[model samples]
Target: MPSFINNIVTLALASLVLVSNVAGDKLIFRNRSDQVRWIDFTPNTDGTNGIGDVRVEPRQDVEFSMDGYGPEWDRGRGWRGNFRAHRDGAPREYDHIVWGEVCFHCDSQHPEFNTFDVSVVRDPNTQEGIHWMYPRGDPGAGLSGCDHFPCSTCYVNSGDNWQTKTTTSNDIYVEIRNS
Candidate 1:
């Protein structure tokens, strides 16, 4: 190969490595509902992501970094949390809407693994449901039948111990819409 072509290839490979090293993994939330929605993240005592409610306008997208949760050692160790979505003007209570519970990087055997589940356990007997899809990354766990009320895809009671885990380290892109 030509010297110039060799140099160019080396630079391109170096650039790709640099970008991948600095680019943090992400959790993207895209709202396809017509109504505005608010996302509330309640992290563990030492976990991050407690920046109050995040508003997402209709047909909009919001991205969140999956990093910065818990301390340096705990980053890959374990961090549990819950995040819920509510319509505009809804009271800031978990019982008023559907929610999701997550255990980010909580696998002791493999810290890269994460467990999560959607639930209506705290709901006030309302007919609220949410639909989520991983368009970019796969968690490699759980079933998806969240098409209607009382969805079989979610936990209906606190006793529901069912959960799913992400087996990959790629950026996760989830689209949540009203159902």
Candidate 2:
């Protein structure tokens, strides 16, 4: 390539590194629910999220640093794929005892947290039920919403015929259901 082109490429590459180092990994947690929800991201190693808690106003998309819970944590490690969310609406009625307890708590694990916006999508439904307690990024099986390993635990992670991960990261989204 030409010298000018080479220099431009070099600049772009350098900028990406700078941003990754300075900004670190982040996730766009969009709240599509009708009520506001308070989010508490617990780092796998037990660090509090920014401000010790995050509140995503109704119908708002917020950016969070999964870069560990506190200063002592792994700053580069993005969201823990876990949350303690509280909404203002009445909790939905369900049949199973586990769903009642699980959704009521709004806590779980999955590696889907590490995905980039390009390949992940959070729909109105279908996400992992925060299955299997562990660092989601690690190699292992996960428990889905139905007590199955690696399945749709929440509506967000569920992909339908209408969409795919490459098209939108909407399924990778989260919501604050009424408590």
Which one wins on TM-score?
A: 1
lDDT of 2 by residue, 3-103 (tens): 99999999999777533532434444555566676554434344535436567787787776544342344433334333544453424232111111111
* Runs with alpha carbons beyond 4 Å of true place in candidate 1: 1-23, 47-49, 71-73, 124-129, 133-135, 143-145
Q: Kindly give the stretch of ten consecutive residues in candidate 2 with the minimal lDDT sum.
A: 97-106
Give the CA lDDT, 0 to 100, for residue 65 in model 2: 52
TM-score of each: 0.70, 0.39
| Model 1 lDDT tens row, 1-179 | 69999999999997775344324655566777888888777876563534567787889888876555543444444336777767888887647566665555565565555556666666624544345534245535544325554665667676767534344443444455666
Q: Which candidate has the highest lDDT of all?
A: 1
TM-score of 1: 0.70
